[model samples]
Target: MSGGVIGTLGIVVLLVLLLARVPVAFAMFLVGFLGIWALNGWNAAMGLLGSETFTLASNPELVVIPLFILMGNVASASGMSRKLYDAAYAMIGQVRGGLASATVIGCGGFAALSGSSVASALTMGKVSLGEMDRFGYDDRLSTGVIAAGGTLGILIPPSTGFVIYAILTEQSIGRLFLAGVLPGLLLLAAFVLTITLLCWRRPELGPPGPSTTAAEKLRSILGAGPILVVVLVTIGGIYGGFFSPVEAAGVGAGMVVVYGFATGTLGLQAFWQASRESIVTTATVMLILIAAHVLNPFIALSQIPASVGAFLTALDLPPTATLLLILAVYMVLGCFLEGFAMLVLTLPIFFPVILQLGIDPIWFGVLVVLTLEMGLISPPVGLNVFIVKSVAPQVPLGRIFRGVLPFWFAMLVTLAILVAFPAISLILPTTMFG
Candidate 1:
């Protein structure tokens, strides 16, 4: 049988395994290993298994993953995330839907610290849901805002999604990080605008919160100073060329740790717990990445990318139309697959097509990450929706899904805007790096 046919079969098996609820790493590993053995030989397969495992395990660039995760874990443990939420609340909680907007802002702030959608959703849901409930906010709006807003974790700087995309595609991490900044802020704004519009139509949806005095606002802002400083330093350092992505991650982690200790918020036991959680999360990411390495070579040997590229070229669709088709596929797949799993499964096939179309890798990375964000809140398997439900169990699953629908549409709009103006995703990287 031809390599293309073998590759196609391998993908079908992979999807079947995923549908059977097999872990992503194991599914990819099983398919990749068998496919490689079939296409090359057992000897070649074993050789790659050893070599790729070691190479990825020892990659210095990957260190950023653990560091950034630790920074976020520590921030959450240290009450920095709560303080950030309080600050946002003090400023905006009095307005209609302001509590929801503050939750969105808080989610964005935590995302900058965490670079993880799951963590952002989990942490922010716990912090914001009760507050919104107390303020007479609609459960749908409160839950929906947390579910959708948490997606900012992957679109903001220090994003694991961007990091994974960069490593997989051999793109520059710094450029991808910079490319995400403007687009992340744009999506956050879109969510806020959606909330405003919703409340405008039905003020009862999110009743106005009690106003805060100026002194209270100032005090709340000061309470959040540590996290704000860490965010500015880490992201600013990268743009100013003062630190590489890895260095920025390390610095951010260190600063958070120091703040946690100084404030007596992160005791030794809490610190240890946070560190352990970071290790587990890091291990999971590493395994997925290693499996992706093995799977990537199998796909290459199968010549599937070449086949897909040729097919796309034959269709003779314009670049923009072709891009939309790819993104639409992502949206459909997002309904079922976890974001990172989808990334590893699809990039090996779609990336080559993207390159052939003269698309900018940095811009595409931002776009892809944004699509991943949508998937996090998309129905069927909307991971963030489930997360919000976990926090607010009284709210039905379907209600959470309904709540997120508008924010999901907001994300769709944001995606459209970014697609129409590529510069929204590229300007920072070009101005800073070029």
Candidate 2:
């Protein structure tokens, strides 16, 4: 068989395997290994695999991943998230859909510490769902809000996905982390506004939490001091060049651990638990990454990205128009694909074309993150929503989907704003890194 035919067939087999519920990383690895062996030879394939594994494992930037994961786990287990939520709730819980709005605020704060969407979803869901349910909040709206809010885990600082994107693309991890700030806030605001509107229209969606006195609200604000301190210290360290991205992660982890211990929130058992969880999560991500690194050579050899670029460029469309088209494609594909797979599969093909079109890579990175965040809450395969569903089985899936519609529109608007004014995503990075 021709080499091209072999490559195509390998891709087909991968799709079939994925449909058959094989893990995505394994399916990708299997197809990649077979394709490389078929196109070249066993010795060459084996050499590339070994070299890629070594390089991926030895990467210094990757150390940040586990550290950040540890920071997240430590912070979550230390009762910091509960304080953050309590503070946010004290401020927002008096309004209609107050608890829901508070969930968004709390999730955004928690997302700062927890970069994994699943972690954010599970943690915040545990914190906020019961409160919302107790307040007679609609299960659909309450669960939906938690699920959608959790996606900020990947959009906000210390995001595992953004870190991986920076590593993969050879971009500055610090800049990417900075670049995510405005967009993350934009999504957070959108969720808050959506909750407000939903509650206004359907009062049963969420009832106001019991009001707090001014003094009590002030005390809650003070209680949030620790969370704010950690966030500012970590971000300031990164942006002020006091620390590299990896160093900042280490600092963050250290701060979280110290806080946990000093406050007596984390005992030896909790410390051990956080470390074990971090190791397991980091291992899973690294394994997938190593597989992707091994597969990338085969993908490059296929010339598929180049071909796709050529095909797109031949359309003679304006850069902005092409970008919109690409975003549309991302949204559609998101309904069926998980975030990491979608990114790895498309970045090679699309990133080059986007760069050639004179789009700023930093700005484009923000846009891509936003698009993938949508995938987390989107229907059919919205992983964040499913995570919430697993916790609240009584709420039908369709209700969650319907409840996210407003926030989705808000996200679309935010996307348009970023596209129209790239500075929204680029200003901080340019100012800080310049």
Candidate 3:
């Protein structure tokens, strides 16, 4: 068989392994290595594996992963996430659907500190779900907000999603980071509007939370100030050109560490726990990146991307039509594949086509990450939905899924807006950096 045929077989074997519960990183690594050995030789495969692993591991830009992850973990350990939730609640809790709206705002704030969507979902779910429940918020709105809002962790500045996309596409991380800012806020606003309309229609879905006194509101804001400052300093530094993305990550991580200890919320035990968690998360991400690197060369040799590009070109579809089809495919895949796995599995084929169509990579990154966000709250494999369920065990899994539906539609609206106005994502990155 030809290299392309062997590559196709390798992908099929990979799907079988994944369905059989193989870990994504290991599964990709295995398929990639074996495919290369089949197409080239064992020596070439082994050589590629060793060199790629070392090269990816040794990449200095990768330092941002661990540092930003550590910053988030430590921030959680320090109770900063709770403070952010409280501040948002205090500011907006009295309005109709206020508590759910606050949860979205809180999730956005925490997203700035924690770039991982899982962490954002888990932490915000814990912090705000109960309060919304207490305010008699509908389970659907309460649970849905947490799951949907958690997605902001991947779209806001300091996002690991953007970081990984940058690494994969060889784009500037700072530019992607900036590009995400407006779109993230736009999505957050859409979520809040969803809640408002829900409450406006039913008037009971999200009952008004008690208003806070002026002093109480001030105190809550003050309480959340330190971590907010850290977020600002890091992101602002990057925007101002005072620091590179790697330097911003280091600064953010360092500041969070100091804040954790100074606040006394992160004791030695908690600190150690956060470190271990960060290390584990970092390792998982690094392994996946290495595996993706290994897989990319094999796929290149397989001519899969070339084949895909030629096929798409042969269709003679308009660029807009082709882009929409690709996005639709991503949305369908999102139902079954975890975002990172789908990203690794598909980008080699799709990214080249996107560029060939003259689409902006940074804008496409936002659209792609938004689709992944949808997947996180989507059914069958909605990771964030499961995370929210774990927080609210009494709420049926089905209810949580139902609750997320409106927010899912809200996400669709945001996606449409971004697609129509690419400038929403591109303005900050282009104006500030260009």
TM-score of each: 0.99, 0.97, 0.98
Best by lDDT: 1
Q: Which pairs clash in the backbone of model 1?
A: none
Over 4 Å off, model 1: none
Of the two candidates 2 and 3, the one with more favorable TM-score, higher being better, is 3
lDDT (Cα atoms) of all candidates against the true structure: 0.94, 0.86, 0.91
Q: Please give the ranking of all candidate structures by lDDT, highest first, separated by commas.
A: 1, 3, 2
TM-score of candidate 3 against the unseen true structure: 0.98
Model 2 alpha-carbon drift over 4 Å, by segment? 1-3
User: How do the residues 1-434 of candidate 2 rate in per-residue lDDT, one tens digit apiece?
Assistant: 76557766776786687667688788778888888998889997899889988998999999989999999999999988888889989998988998998998999998888788889889989998989999888887888888888989999998998987886777888999999988899889888888888888889788889999999899999988988998998888888889998898898999989988998999999999999999999988887788777666777777776777888889999999999999998998788888887776677668889888999888888898889988888888889988998888888889988877777788889899989989989988999978
- In candidate 1, what are the lDDT values of residues 354-387, reduced to their tens digit? 9999999888888889999899988898999988
Q: After aligning candidate 3 to the native by TM-score, how far in Å is the CA of 177 from where it should be? A: 0.6
Worst 10 residues of 1 by lDDT: 128-137
220 Cα displacement, candidate 3 (Å): 1.3
